[model samples]
Target: MALDPTDVGKIAELARLEISEPELTSYVHSLTQILDLVGQMNAVDTAGISPMAHPSDSPLRLRQDIVTEQDRRQSFQEIAPATESGLYLVPKVIE
Candidate 1:
């Protein structure tokens, strides 16, 4: 799939970019090569292969669902600029 210079110009206009003639030519060539490579990859046959999520050497292990934290309300509130009734206070912005 060969992308045209005019198409690249239109894309640049939409993105608010000023692409020069040399850069546009380079981009078109690179994009064409990438499309060609993808087209080549489309010819591969992978019919019944299971998709592996993670590729790791060792056995995967998940941590148990447990809350390992201490309640630090006073410590947290101490850093706040303004606080009211154990909650951080913010300026009312509604008209």
Candidate 2:
């Protein structure tokens, strides 16, 4: 797909980008090449292929989901400026 200067300018306006004329010309060329590349990639046939998170078959190694810290809520809450019923109290800023 070919992108003209007007199209590029509209895209830049929508993205809130301040682009100069020289940069707009450069971006037009670069964006046109990227779209062409994406079009070519989309033309490939990948029938009967399963989607994968990674190319390799190795499973992800993750740490066990277990609590590793002692619960010191009461000790920490004692130093706070305001706390009530195991929850912190804050001023109502909005009316």
List all candidate RMSDs to the true structure.
8.7, 8.8
lDDT of each: 0.86, 0.94
Q: List the residue pairs that clash in candidate 2.
A: none
Q: What does candidate 2's lDDT look like per residue over 1-95, in tens digits?
A: 99999999999999999899999999999999999988887677889888787888799789989999899999999999999999999998799
Candidate 2, which segments miss by more than 4 Å at Cα? Answer: 45-95
What is the overall TM-score of model 2 with all chains considered together? 0.46
RMSD score of candidate 2 (Å): 8.8
Determine which window of 10 residues in candidate 2 has minimal summed lDDT: 41-50
Residue 17, candidate 1: Cα error in Å is: 2.7
Best by TM-score: 2
Compose the digit string of candidate 1's lDDT tens values, residues 3-78: 8899888888999999999999998888778888888976878789776777774677888889888999989999
